[model samples]
Target: MIGAGSTVIFHFDIKLSDGSAAESTRVHNKPAKLQMGDGSLSPAFEAELSGMQAGDKKTFTLEPQDAYGMPNPDNIYYVDRSKFSLDAPAQVGMIIGFAMPDGSELPGLVREVVGDSVTIDFNHPLAGQTLTFNVEIVQVIN
Candidate 1:
């Protein structure tokens, strides 16, 4: 059984609330490994994975807040078109990385591009959405 110290490997298929596929490790024929008691996954995710054994299959759903949290208004920003480099023009649906004051890069998607302004959304692409996870436990090592 999977417990706090167990290392479990599993294959997962993720779907959005709209019934569209988000991701699936089965397509790559690779199983994901996770060590319990570590902070690799969210608390809710860990809770859901606990107490399962190898070869077990389950489908669970996570709410927006429990999954990626709700979208923050502060994450949306509008920048002038001139802020982008001429060689790298900003276009709608583009994912661009902007350097922060701490020298770390934050990725933002171009939501809209007007004549002189570009609206970028820093919220995670999955934010504010319900998620379904279909998981198959392949192995467990204590």
Candidate 2:
């Protein structure tokens, strides 16, 4: 059986609130190994995995706050249309990666395009919605 601080290997499928698959470790055939209660996952998300034995399969849902937190309106920003290259076409639902001041890339979705401005939402697409995860514990490695 798995307990807190145990290192375990597992495969999981994450689905969006709309029932769309967001990611799956099984697709790549790679099982993930992690220590329980090790800050590798959100507290709420990890709580569901506690006290499970190897070969156990479970499915659970997590609310936004417990997953990625709610989307904030302040994350929406408008950029001048001219900032984009004239050859680059802007469209709704397009994900644009922006370089932060720290040199890290942050992805933002194009929400709308106006005459001279483009609205971008920096919030995570999964924000403000519940997520479902289908997980199978493949092995318990101490």
Candidate 3:
């Protein structure tokens, strides 16, 4: 059974509330593996997968809070347009990578560009939306 401390290999399809596909692992013929109770998954997500065995298929819906959580207004920031490269001008709906203090890149979506101010939203693209997950468990190591 899949429970705490179990390692699970599964393929999943995620869809938005409008029934639009968001992401799927099977598209690439690759399954995902994760350890139960790992920080990679939220507690609510873990609860949904508890007590299942290999070969079990399940579909579940998660509200915003249980999934990516609601977007925070504070995550929006304004940056100077000059910060963007000429090759990739700041355009609305463009996802840009900003260098972090830790030397890693953080992705931010461009929301608006007016004069020299470019508005960027740092929230996850699916943050405020409910999502449905279709999962097929291929293997489980307890």
Candidate 4:
């Protein structure tokens, strides 16, 4: 069983409320290793792993607040079309990566493609929706 300070390797799949698979370690053919209580995983998500033994398979769902938090309307913004290259096509539902002031790359979804303006939302697509996780405990080291 796993406890505080234990090193563990597990495979997990995250799915959105609509049954779309958002991410999966199994798909990559790798397992994630992490130390318990190390701040790598959210406290709420980690709490679900407590007391789980090796070889255990579990599935659970979490609300938006417990997962990635609800989406904020303020995250949506309009950008001037001139900022994009004229050769680049602008279309709704496209995900564009933008560099942040901190040098981090943030992805924004294009919601509207007007004549000279584009509406983008920086919030995670999964935000504001319940998520389901399927996890399999592959290893546990104390």
Q: How many residue pairs clash in each candidate at the backbone level?
A: 0, 0, 0, 0
lDDT of 4 at 98: 94
lDDT of 3: 0.94
Candidate number of the best lDDT: 3
In candidate 4, what are the lDDT values of residues 1-142, reduced to their tens digit? 8899999899999998889999999887899999999987767788899999899999999888878889999999999988888687778998999999999999999999889999999998888989999999999999
The better candidate by lDDT, 1 or 4, is 1
In angstroms, the error of model 4 at 67 is 1.3
Better of 2 and 4 by TM-score: 4
Model 3 worst lDDT run, 10 consecutive residues = 37-46
- Count of clashes in candidate 3: 0
What are the models' TM-scores?
Answer: 0.82, 0.80, 0.93, 0.83
Per-model CA lDDT versus the true structure: 0.92, 0.90, 0.94, 0.91
Better of 1 and 4 by TM-score: 4
Give the least accurate 10-residue stretch of model 2, judged by summed lDDT. 37-46
lDDT of 1 by residue, 18-61 (tens): 88999899998999998987977777887888999998999999
**CA RMSD of each candidate after superposition:** 2.4, 2.4, 1.3, 2.2
Worst 10 residues of 4 by lDDT: 82-91
Q: List the residue pairs that clash in candidate 1.
A: none
List the candidate numbers ranked by lDDT, top first: 3, 1, 4, 2
Which regions in candidate 3 have their CA more than 4 angstroms from the true location? Answer: none
Residue-by-residue lDDT tens digits, candidate 3, 33-132: 9999878887888888899888999999999999988999999999999998899899999998989999999999999999999999999998999999
